[model samples]
Target: MTTIVLGAGAVGTATAWYLRKSGHDVVLIERQPEAAMETSWGNGGIIHASEVEPWSQPGMPTKIIKWLGKENAPLLLRYRAIPHIMRWGIEFARNCTPERFRENAKSNLHLALHSLKSLQEIGAEAGIDYDRATRGVLKIYRSRDSLDSAQRSTDYLAQHGLLYERADPDRCVELEPALKDTKSTLAGALYFARDEVGDSNKFAQGLAAACAARGVQCRFGETIEKIETRSGRVQAVVTSKGRIVADTVVVALGSFTAPMLAKNGIRVPIYPVKGVSITFKRAAWNAAPTMPLIDDSKLFGFVPIGDRIRISGSAEITGYDMTPAPARVAAIIANASFTFPELKRYFDISKSKVWAGLRPVSPTGTPIIGETRIRGLWINAGHGHLGWTLSCGSGRVIADLIDGRDPGIPVPPPQGVVVARAA
Candidate 1:
């Protein structure tokens, strides 16, 4: 059976690998010249299971309201995007209750752990080296109250196989000596020992090469014009080059999935939430911390990937715009310095590379993975900011479902997409 995997980002590339491994003829398509060139390109690179809590957690509505129009806010909602995100925002609000937040966290953690295992397998099989750091991530909190609140979430996730330890101010510095030159005194921290970091773009590119070497057809630099169907079944995908008949079509187009599928009258709850990142060369910064740092108070992360450092964070409810906001980038730099002030003395901030990409977020915080209402049409998208963290697992699950096997873990039911009226 020939299966068409759309969009060769991290998730789509992984799906093609698993599908080919399952003995299916797989063709992976991407508009870019290579895989992971978009959202997967410049992420903070932390495959953190500790950060499973959704953005719609308790009291988040008030926070979003207060953050409205603030350029430097952790989560900003541009006034122009309000009209486009109104319906999605309502569903996001609906998932903000305490009970729902915990349940969503549980679901996210399950997929995240499974993804890590799958990623290890991929790394070994593909022989790809992606500057991996195994020291784990340290999340620091400035206030005792915030630390206590985070502890509750971490403690609950611990029951579901998350390994973590509560760290005092001294332990926080002990975990990462680079934190000793802090600008302000830290209240406490939480360290997730199982979390790891790596360059996702490198991994994706290597995996794509592996897939092609294994005889999976990889057609990059091709624009998908439409999905052709007959008798309510996925018949083929019409691309700019030509139509390729397919037995199954998996939509893994990240933030573009909703619009692409909506063209065929299939509506998904996925919304495009923009995020910003800045990468810097670690020139002359010999003492850069090996372990990733997540500042919970400031809502930013400083991750050292190889000889370069990546500072990334922010959830902007903006529609489809991929332009990086300089103000937001500067805000992230300032926030990152709060935990690692030595960056100013050691690294050149003027040479930082700024980037922005859209994260395809679901209201439930769980990726929508399964066969949709359309026969032979599947979905493996809406991984949100966890695209790299959840990529391989989501791909493996899609392959298992297509191959008539259990997905190893319970998956959300099919036909869960919200059908939208045609404009």
Candidate 2:
């Protein structure tokens, strides 16, 4: 059977790669001239399985309300987006309970760990070198309360194969020498020994090339107009150029996944959450962390992607807008300056690249991946901020399903109108 995977971001590219690897004839389509030119192009580029907790955790509502309207706030809800997101917001609110929060975290962690393993396998198979690093992810906390809460979360995840070490201020500097300047300002840090980092854009591009070598049709510069359905099954994908008869379709369009399927009267609870990143050329090193670091107190992090430093963090409920707000970019820089005092000396604002991309977020913080009510149609979307982190595993599972084989790992049920496991 011929399978068509839509969009060429990391998620879609990974899906196509796995489909072809599993002995299926696949056609990869993208609106752009090439792959990874959208959200996957400008991410923080960290594959962080350590950061598996969802945003909709207990007591998060009050934090969101408190941070409203602040430009530098970690979570921003644009007033204009409130009405459009009312239904999703209600679901988000309902999932704030301790039970739901733990369940969602477990679901995300399962796939994230699987994705991490799958990523290494793909890299070995494809010989991809996206400036890979395995120094682990350091999440620093500024307050005792925050550190304690994260410790509790880590303890739960520890039972599920997450290896982490509690680092004091001195130990943190030993882990990442860049923090040597501000050791006194830190309460403590959680160093996740299992997490890794890399440039996601390069991963998508490299994997796409491998897919082409494997005889998967790479059709670029064609936009999807609609999915022609016949008797509750996908018939052909109508694109700008022409139609291709497809036996199956996997919708991996990221934030655009929901709207595209909605045109076919299928409602997936995927919505766009905007995030921004600023990449700077690393000057002959004054103080840049070699390891990936996320500040729990400040809600931002910077990682070394090759010789470049990329600082990214922020959750804005902006609807489908990919414009990089200058203030937001500046705020990211300012937030990093506090953590790394010498970062300003090396960061050249004029030479930096600022980018914004919409993350396809679901209310439960668990990606919706399964076979939908419509036969011959499948979904691998709603990965949220972990799109890069979840891509490889999601793709492998979906492809396994299409091949009528076991996925080897538990997958989250596809939310909304989805009625069956992908198998």
Per-residue error (Å), model 2, residue 320: 0.6
TM-scores, each model vs. reference: 0.97, 0.98
For model 2, the run of ten residues with the poorest summed lDDT? 414-423
Runs of candidate 2 with Cα error greater than 4 angstroms are none
Candidate 2 per-residue lDDT over residues 14-101, each given as its tens digit? 9999998878899999999989999999898889889888888999888888978888888898888888998899889999999999
Top lDDT prediction, candidate number: 2
Model 1 residue 115 CA deviation (Å) reads 0.7
Shift in Å, residue 394, candidate 1: 0.5
Question: Global CA lDDT of candidate 1, please?
Answer: 0.87
- Backbone clash total, candidate 1: 0
TM for candidate 1 is: 0.97
Each model's lDDT? 0.87, 0.89
Winning candidate number (TM-score): 2
